[model samples]
Target: MSLPPITSIHNPKIQRVRALLGRRSEREEQSAYVVEGVRLLEEAAAAHLHPQLLLYTPDLAPRAQQLVHTFQKAGVECLPLAPALFASVAGTESPQGLLAVLPLPASQLPSQPNFVVIADNLRDPGNLGTLLRTSAAAGAQALLLSPGCADAFSPKVVRSAMGAHFRLPMWAAAWDEIAAWIHQHSLSVFLADANLGQPYWQVNLRPPLALVIGSEAEGPGPQSAALATGYLSIPMPGGVESLNAAVAAGILLFEVARQRAAA
Candidate 1:
């Protein structure tokens, strides 16, 4: 096997990686995304994804060293990078000094999804990312986002998603398109709301079901709201208006998982 290559920050390939790191369009155009941190890298590799390139700083731990060689042996082009340069390209505040360029899976949603979460106009990156992460962990089959929602594959979102992007099938479309998809699949669309809705535990989440959670600033969009098969909500004490988008989604997704597993 060829030894790893060492390159400077100004190298053309390195610059391209950094540029792609910042732009969602570039990531889509290249059909690859930058995965940072040791944990995420491990998840990507454990998922059996072949990295196009793996970049790491000199301070790589002994475990990271083993991974570098293993990944290199698996045909990944490992690049040794300077810590300062790695930090310059990282999206997180505490740089992990390691990242990989991974091609995203192009799996489309199933025609008839057993379970999913429809995100509408969700603007918060952290919330969206956490939702993706939780959805993947809870074993949701897919995620469909409305036009105004945060970009699922954006750097911040991807970082928060961890390796969820690789694990979950996702699509971004308009509310009308999403509604049409639900009907075509004969899906039971459940809209999560704060009022005039049954408690989530009251619903049967098994079979064809799509749970909808709208933007924090506003609830589900008009189209999804109108088409919702049922409006669902979690019963909360203390007179709270609602929970955070991420928390609410986690609850709903696990409920689906609970129902599906029991059934």
Candidate 2:
């Protein structure tokens, strides 16, 4: 059942949403994040990701209204917000009619993963988000983040990812833990470097492997470099110095997929 529309900007629920939108720390502390837009909400629903709370405006279009109804029938707490109040807490320039407070999905790494992605010092949320999308599309079994990468669940990353969060297991761990996991899996670790090792296509990507992508500005840190069994460079005959981290990740990940498919 829908609660009475909240008119006050001081409402506790509104305040909680604002906090979640603004702070990564708050999200981590609560183990929840705010997800905005009809598209993301639809994806969440399709994945059977139930929300802890649903907030919407009264003037929602038919489809959005139906989405609100669906959540309501699922027994989620639905709160209607005044339009201005909704806009105030929304992360986007234009507020979507609906947003939700959802717990982070319980994604776990598989026991034996043939392919994985690791983000090393990738500070750009857009790049990291694109990497997440590409990694999921390429059938990576998991994504691991080193310390310096942007928070994967942040609003901008989440928006840029376009629902990729629901599709893969992700973890942010220390170098020690990462190295231990790689060792346990007995997987080869390859660093994607602009000028190093064999050409990416020549690499035998058929084995269980983890690809580490670093920042374009700083490249991989010592921690990541220490873990690489080898490096792979994309061939660029066009004379570009280096590709964007996310673009490089896409090219490499898809190559892995292509090679595995042909094998």
Backbone Cα, N, C clashes tallied per candidate? 0, 0
Candidate 1 accuracy as TM-score: 0.92
| Cα error, candidate 1, residue 23 (Å) | 1.7
- Cα lDDT of model 2 by residue, 1-263, tens digit: 54677989888989999899899999999999988999999999998889999999999998899999899989999999989888888999998779999997665988988799999989999999999999999999999999988999999999999999989889999999999999999989999998898999989999999999999998888998999999999889999999999999999999999999999
Candidate 1 wrongly placed segments (more than 4 Å): 1-7
Cα lDDT of model 1 by residue, 76-110, tens digit: 98888767777777777997678888886775887
Q: After superposition, how far is residue 82 of candidate 2 from its true place, in Å?
A: 1.0
What TM-score goes with each of the models?
0.92, 0.97
Leading candidate by TM-score: 2
